[model samples]
Target: MTRSVRRTRRILQVTGVSAAALLALSACSSSDSDSSASASASGKLSGDVTVFAAASLKESFTTLGKEFEKQHPGTKVTFSFGGSDSLAASITGGAPADVFASASPKTMKIVTDAKDNATEPATFVRNQLEIATLPGNPDKVASLKDLTNSDLKVVLCDRTVPCGAAAQKALDASKLKLTPVSYEEDVKSALNKVVLKEADAAVVYKTDVKAAGEKVEGVEFPESADAVNDYPITLLKESKNPETAKAFMALVQSAEGQKVLNESGFLNP
Candidate 1:
């Protein structure tokens, strides 16, 4: 071969080898990216997520948590359900929970204000106060005013909790004065009083009454319209499993989650 031809061939072979090497590296990078994306798309979530939620969310959230665990096989969801204010306190006090779902924005503010939330809180549900009474509503409590009867043993939630705050608002709107026999710290506690026949009536969320089942009868009062508690939820800043926590939050806002809440008597946010 001519010297020029030999030189040109050598140059071409070198260029060809370099191109092959470049192509192989590009292919490997693309493969890695595709694998990462595929893993993400498969929704492979695995972790133990702790959720602090409102007392009234017990039944519905429990159902949703089971569904979440089913969808994310290796994932576990543990819950702490109580008054919204108390839950907020725990979160603000450095409780290592993955998510926080409050019954009212006011209580959620406690966490958001303390910068304990990872994202801006979103309202997930709204609830209104209802009169929970003995089975069949033995006292015939039809409206908010009926609870004002001095003879009836009525229990109210502590003013600090979402349910209690809502109850107070409803009473203020109705311009009625009531002296409850006892003020419970949470809606569930107030509802339990009626369920146990310790109190004749208690003002609690409609969802709570439904959760109580045959133990108590619910009375819809117009005054409840004045006070609707907006439940807010968010991933906490201290969440050890942020990705799993976010997935759970998304599930709670999904259609399936809403269905469970609706079935439990909670209104849509």
Candidate 2:
């Protein structure tokens, strides 16, 4: 073979090898970019996030949970809703939970004081007390004083719960001494009593009355202004899915989440 021919072949060989290397590198780069894009698009949250939330949050939080699942495919959110104090007790007792959302800062303090929270609790919403009465206000209840009627069988949340505490604060503020027919464990139970016609009226959260819809009539008493409850939410330290839990917390504080809460009659924090 001629020297020039040999030189040309050598150059062609080198070029071919270089072209193959370049193509391989390009393919790898493309693959990596695709993988990253897919991951970003799919969102990083997965697994289940168990949330311990207040009873009043059942309706709003459930809605947010569904939305969170929709935004993060393959992720599930399970909620345990009850009195803030009771939920706090459960979380502090080493219950397995990804997040804790309380209807009052007082209850949230239990988790924070126990060092069970991964982060400082953030207040997401506020709620006030309302008297939930039978539909059409058949009892002719108009104010807090009306609930004190001897003939009325009024129910209230247990003093340990956020709703009951708020109700007590409102009553204290009004300087009214009234005995409730029963003190239920949570706001929902207190509201349920009125809805089921087991009680003439129930002092519950305004959100609870709203959730009850036509089943109960909400009577807003001015005294409730003094006992507004601030709802706080935090990621738990023992979360099995911390990333997903934090993402869920962010979703709850997001504008979209606030919209859901507002529609459910919760006041902005």
Candidate 3:
């Protein structure tokens, strides 16, 4: 072959190789783009986030869960609502949970002490003890001192729960000793006793009384100021969905969260 012909052939060979390389690069780029698009379009955050909260928070949390679902379209929020101390025990026993919101810092300490806490908990709300009485206040049980009256049938939360602890503090502060006929496991049950007229009065959370609405009347007492309880919330260290848990925490700490809590009669922390 002539030298010019040979040079032209070499040039053609180089052009063909360049075209092949360009085609390979384009194919790789397209594959990556498609993968990313598929991942983005799936619209599913697949994981279970178990939340343990105090029983008094049942109604408020049910509302908040719906709101959270609205905010995070595909996320699932599973709640285990009960007495804070009982929930604490469940968490300590290796029950899986992503978050915990306790009515008292003391109960939260149980998880924190076990090193199962994800981070430092924040006080989202505060609650004080209140006297939940019959609809018409028939007994006229007006004050903490009055609870000591032998004629009154008073009930209180179990000593292990926050409400019970606060009730004790209030009674101690007033230097009044009263014998409650029963010590319910949680605030709601104690309040229920009054609602059902099983007891004449019960020392429960302000929020619980508000939740009960017209079923029972809440009478504020001066002694309640001495037993204000602080509620703390934290994410669990063993969470399978940390990102979603963090997002939920942000919502609880947000202005919107505060509005819901306040509307439900919880005091600002």
Candidate 4:
């Protein structure tokens, strides 16, 4: 048979009896369902599940998104990754998304306070800050204080971003005031500066450094302990695909999901 003929047959099959069965199964997991939330764990998932997430979660969330699609063949996982604060703003401004995974509770509050979440946010994982330096540690930087040197061109996430907030908390705890050459909008942007050799170092999440691999070197600082960020996930109130969104959220908080995140260098919540 020709390719178009095969494609038409596939479309017809999807809209047949199988589609009705899926819709029936999906109702069991819908936010309005009287069924327990756990029903979503085993129910059929379909349609598009759009997620707005923190930039720090890009790698791990992408891994989970692929797995979500694998688990439910007809479902698609689309993501909008950026600074947590900016993402929250978009959601509250009526951007359509099924789920929201924020890098910090403070940013999540923006959505929750606006009553934009269908469910209470849950802390799924935590992340800590690390100094991302150019490969070979060209500056021989040893601690967070090392970045304070006026000679080093350092980058940091903007203060409104989660990673930036955590870095500031760490700095305050250490009583150090390090000025960065630039403040990028998100953690990835900050790390990109170091990776592209635009800056000597940047303060970013440990996961980001691990994701960068050979592109940048990670330096651990004791103050990071004082600034660990809690990552939260929630189902959006405006989600058009509640069943699939709940299933995706369940997968994110599942054991298998935790394994993917842990492997990416995120700490347990």
Per residue, candidate 4 scores C-alpha lDDT tens digits across 1-269 of 99999999989988897889888788756845655655666666779989999999999999999999998999999999999999999998889998999999999999999964557999999999999999999899999999899999999999999999999999999999988999999999999998889999999999999999999999999999999999999998888999889999989899999999999999999
Worst 10-residue lDDT window for candidate 4 reads 31-40
State the TM-score for model 4.
Answer: 0.84
lDDT of 1 by residue, 1-269 (tens): 79999999999999999999999999999999999999989868998999999999999999999999999899999999998888888888888898999998888898899953657999999998899999988889988999999999999999999899999999998899999999998999999899889999999999998888899999999889999989899988788999999999999999999999999998999
Off by over 4 Å in 4: 1-42
Query: Relative to the true structure, how large is the alpha-carbon lDDT of every model?
Result: 0.92, 0.91, 0.89, 0.92
Clashes per candidate (backbone, < 3 Å): 0, 0, 0, 0
Range of the 10 consecutive residues with the lowest summed lDDT in candidate 2: 113-122
Ranking of all candidate structures by their lDDT, best first: 4, 1, 2, 3
TM-score against truth, every candidate: 0.85, 0.85, 0.87, 0.84
Q: In candidate 4, how many Å is residue 94 off?
A: 0.4
- Please say which candidate is ahead in lDDT: 1 or 4: 4
Q: Give the root-mean-square deviation of each candidate in angstroms.
A: 5.3, 4.6, 4.1, 13.6
Q: Which stretches of candidate 2 lie over 4 Å from their true place?
A: 1-43
Task: Return the top candidate by lDDT.
Answer: 4
For 15-52, candidate 2 gives per-residue lDDT tens digits of 99999999999999999999999997975778999999
TM-score quality measure for candidate 1 = 0.85
